[model samples]
Target: MKLEALAVYEQPLKWFALGLGVCSTVCVVQGWQLAAMLFSLPFCLIWMYSGWLRTEPQLKYINMLFSVLYVYGIGRYFWLQA
Candidate 1:
């Protein structure tokens, strides 16, 4: 990707990852498990994207693990409710 494109992509991902992380935390604190799970989905993806842009191995792996955890949370939320 071009420098400009990468820069643009990096900015939103940073803001979004932060915003979604906070939002997800709030959802859980408010006793909204499903909402937290849903919110974390995008948060993890944006984090992973940011990691990719910066070529950060640790960030990429951490976010990848979080994404899996989010997916499991989503599934468990529904599974237990049914």
Candidate 2:
């Protein structure tokens, strides 16, 4: 597998998602669920955009499910803690 073939996406959003994913992992391990979800927002958003751009129904639906689950987790852990 050549990296050149897989490097078709020439956008800053992918990099943004990567950075956020790393930070989100750190936040999760630190017990900062709210922050983790917040960080993951950009990553999920990018996937949603690319998923549609790629015309991939499966990718789009999976990303949609992940987005919903992420939001639900945030609400359940952060909002309901009160």
Q: Assess candidate 1 and give its TM-score to the true structure.
A: 0.81
Q: Compose the digit string of candidate 1's lDDT tens values, residues 1-82.
A: 5644766767767787788889989998999988988988998888787787778899899989989998998888889989
TM-score of each: 0.81, 0.75
Candidate 2 per-residue C-alpha lDDT over 1-82 given as tens digits, one digit per residue, 9 for 90 to 100: 6433444663777887889999999998998878998888668877877777777788778878888888888788866788
Candidate 2 has its poorest 10 consecutive residues by lDDT at 1-10
The residue-level lDDT of candidate 1 at 60 comes to 91
Q: Pick the candidate with the highest TM-score.
A: 1
